[model samples]
Target: MTDPDTAATDAHLLETLANLRWNRFHTIVVLLFGLGWALDAFEVTLIGNVLGALRQHFHLGSNAMSFILAAWFAGLMLGASGFGILSDRYGRRRVFLASLVLYGVATLATAFAPDLAALMVLRLIAGIGVGAEYAAINAAIAELVPSRSRGRASAIVLNFWPVGSFVAALLAWLVLSALPADLGWRVVFALGGAIALSAAWFRRHLPESPRWLIEAGRREDARVIIGRIAAGLTDATTLAPAPVVQRVRREVNGLRVLLRHYPGRLALGAVLDFAEASGYYGLFAFLPIVVLPALHLPPARLPLFYLAGSVGALIGGFAAASLLDRIGRGVTVAGFYLATALALIGFAAITGMGAGAIMLGFALVNLLATGSWIAAYPMFAELFPTSLRATGIGASVAVGRIGAALSPFLVGYVGARSMPAALVMLAGFWALGAVAVLVWRRRGGIEARGLALEQLAVEPARYV
Candidate 1:
């Protein structure tokens, strides 16, 4: 009961898409997609780096500051879910640009806060914009890039988070070293917003995903975009027009669809995200407040540690990007997770040791732990079907945001009791993520390496 041309028409378009050689458009997608995530990292790193200064200026204790950080995470959860649904339903372009402006203005406003409460309010709003980036950017990148280099491309893009952190640390150190304590931290925040505002120009040139258009049943629009893309594959490209399959595709509406289809993937995504947030927000975020003070390091000196860790992060990101496509995702994710656990456990064992030993341990944690991010975002983005990709990613990020939101408070409680205990607990979070990936892979999770999204999602299993 099928047209013989069905396989050559809609399915053929995906083949041409997957086979297209790298082009300028692909590079543009990578940089722009990565920027959304980087801004989030820049803001987070700036706040974490400057927390010590904020506490002192506001006359606030550890717990009070923890609650303020929690406010930011709460906003991230709200925005990830809210904008994800909006982007998935309405379109990615509108939400992506709009959130940038919103977060930019909010982050800029944060520098002028009259009091701690005012800063908290602004941070919450800025967080929503950052949160929106996770789903919109990931979904778009997954669909836009060629299938052959998809894993490496996604890894490279998501790894921008570390680059943002590095830049933030450098900026923080420079500002704090030169300016007075009160003015220095404020300037760091203002700069983050200014950088985000500039990204609107590059993002404007990005094209919508053809797969999403086809999935949405916009046949002519999909063909037009695909025609332009196919023609520009190279000077000698002779790609043909994609067949117009007129079958009515049933589109599901709501988060419930994810549960019905990819319950395991959805669950695993939430666990990885939640666990990553717990460790990052709990240990790394709290380190400046707790460990740095113990080491007799000033706030300005925090970037030195961040700088050292970022070296490992850059190394890790590059390694993950190279190794992910070669070694299977299962091996990469598990290997990185296991390495991170060991780093944390090692850090916990030598807690009262000299600052040098502590710093080395933290550096290893950043190298291995942050490196795993290369695989994490891509894994989640690739696992779900095209129709549900944004919502699925959004849901997972929302769950992770819950863990991220709670992590600050939890860090205060545990760190107050014993820093050693906190490190050990944070290690447990990474261990759990490793376990989740292994378990999910065993449950027949599909790897998207060098595979077109249309065949994997839009067609039947035999065709795939």
Candidate 2:
């Protein structure tokens, strides 16, 4: 039995979702964001796909490889913190574009690393670019997309990440199969760097955010951009002329301001970050470990399983976009995380059973978990206002990176001690993440709605 108010709220959300559509600029922005996200994912996951080859080629041990992995995560943490502040102080577009170029170059440079130390440094630098991009891109999409479809749009955009990883997996299979031993991993790294350069060109055509422009006291320019966007609105029946928005300049007081004013938002952001980081690393980072064993497949078969997970992730991302408004961010996340927790547990159980069961569970785990994971990013991005959106997201990403950094270590530790227990423990992380979302809901509902971004522009002081 359902409550009337809940039912009415659900109905209204459905109606809102039905009416959701993005202008061309916004759509292009999301597509590019998706592509960039996918490329980033591909680059990061390439290491996992080539870890064995890297060790064999470089005469590296497992311990040394682990250190390299840590270096990458450390770079991510630094980049997230540094660029988050930069996004607020400078502007989203400049920082966003710069980070892309930096990462692209660093990724490409990996192909020529002379030693393990050199590889570590290059990967660390690449991690920073990757880390910085998350905040810039999430902030860009949140500010650009209409409020009614923000949640769904963000989710859909994020879904392309798995596609990138899937592509990497496919490439890994192809290279490992066909390429000469010494040149294979180099090709993978070079490709990551090359693809990242495309983000720069794509971003060039993107206009600076109108919301950001108004905030920075560039009203005239903001108006011009808005007019251009509105010019293409085929259905302008509900559209209004751009109003004169007063500028509200923001300061860059990195950590202190974030801690003092919006403590709850910061806390919520961290919780979401932890949940997302743990779940994502567990599923995608550990893909080769979990899926290959479960399927009893040879090493060559690993990419095919990874490809299946990527397909599931794409489905999840699109499904989230289609259903986010009707489901509401909190409800959708809570439901998704809860289901993911159960699926992870079920996956563990089925893995021990047999090959047929493992394949079925492998697909189902990713199918459920990936969708649930897709819903988190948009909702997480929305939790803070524009003033702290980048910073908050950056801080959250930093905190989340810690969890991600810890996962491989934990997985290794657990595998060393007991494999099944490690599997079950990952499931527990998902359950804890579900609890975090429920806690967030008890404090507040969805972060923004119905022109709230516009309203924030009206009274920027209210947000700060």
Candidate 3:
């Protein structure tokens, strides 16, 4: 058992961390970890942008191409579940770094795929890397960042999703327009691989989460890491501190922990992800491709519209980042969902008002709906203990991938018949997600705004 003095000291350690000024190390963490999602967006967005080209090159129809999306999501679910457990059991730095390498190599190899089967296989491999990143990066940032700033820090980290998408759009537009059709798509994949590879080196300097180390009973090690990060603080002069008596629990299987012990969180995460993924993958990401057919827009000018939509995501993401700490998770999440649903309804309302109206609707949905992605990760990161953090988040993301995998097909089919109905269906997704979050909160989910992970960890213990 922890004595009062040691408990106070441990609390001081967290307080000291929470009070540290944002500096070079924090910037490095953001850039390195942020790149994980950026590369994922880049790769996935590239697939979306280049789908027409792939269809032409491989003689695939829309249905077959959709399976490619499904395959990627399948790999994502597998990697998120598998790697989440691995990272929790092994170590964050190793699992996340290796996931990046795996993504890079797979993406680079995708450039050389000789046939459709080979290409699909390569995409699945790349998706695993992307999928693993979601769990690893979120867990690391939540544990490492100061408690007071965890919301903004994590928000900034995840906001890279749009940046990645925008970069992909830019590359695809420039490359596909400038180079030979066959070679341009290959270059885009190569570009993603190279960026991911380059980012891995910088990750080496990142420290293990002090919280995780402490949970594992490595008190001295955790203390040293905290000392190093807080080196400039007036009191952290010691390389080693006296060991604190901590309550080190046996490692539980993370899956069992979520399924049996903290079932509400598991249910909340699954439902939240399912709704967000359905709308995001079904409509937002897939919208640009469908607009030409659904709204009678010119195919040649779609890139400009797509760029505008991507920019909206960035705007909304940053806005959410700023508000997350202020509004608290429950309000922010519930509000975003309700607003996103309304935006989708408005989008459906303008189905035949000409291309301009449709475009505007798309932009609004892009902006408001992005909150789902922006808020989801930070909230998931906050929900579990250090021991179960990665697993819980990974399982959440895995559930998300399942929803994402089916959404494109569902959206494609529905939109082809009636754009209005499709938009409303997407709205329904948002409502479902919002309801899940609100219900979960009522049933014992903590709001987790500015609290430290240590503080948040205590809440679920009561119910679990």
List, residue by residue over 147-260, the lDDT tens digit for candidate 3: 778898899988998898889888887887887768878887888789888877766667777776666556667777777776632222233432223221244456886787
> Model 2: clashing residue pairs?
none
What lDDT does each candidate get?
Answer: 0.78, 0.71, 0.78
- Output the worst ten-in-a-row residue range by lDDT, candidate 2: 234-243
Q: Which stretches of candidate 3 lie over 4 Å from their true place?
A: 1-12, 232-252, 293-302, 459-464
Query: What TM-score, to 2 decimals, does candidate 1 have?
Result: 0.91
Error of 2 at 61 (Å): 4.2
Candidate 1 clash pair list: none
Query: By summed lDDT, which 10 consecutive residues of candidate 1 come out lowest?
Result: 234-243
Residue-level lDDT of model 1, residues 83-180, one tens digit each, is 88766665566677888888888999998999998999999999898888888888888877788888899899888888988898899989999998
Q: lDDT tens digits, residues 60-156, model 2?
A: 6545656677788888888987898777666677778888899999999998888888999999999999999888888888877767777777887
lDDT of 1: 0.78
| TM-score, model 3 to reference | 0.91
Task: Give the range of the ten consecutive residues with the poorest summed lDDT in model 3.
Answer: 233-242
What local lDDT score does residue 434 receive in model 1, on the 0 to 100 scale?
Answer: 94
Best by lDDT: 3
The better-scoring model by TM-score among 2 and 3 is 3
Error of 3 at 150 (Å): 0.6
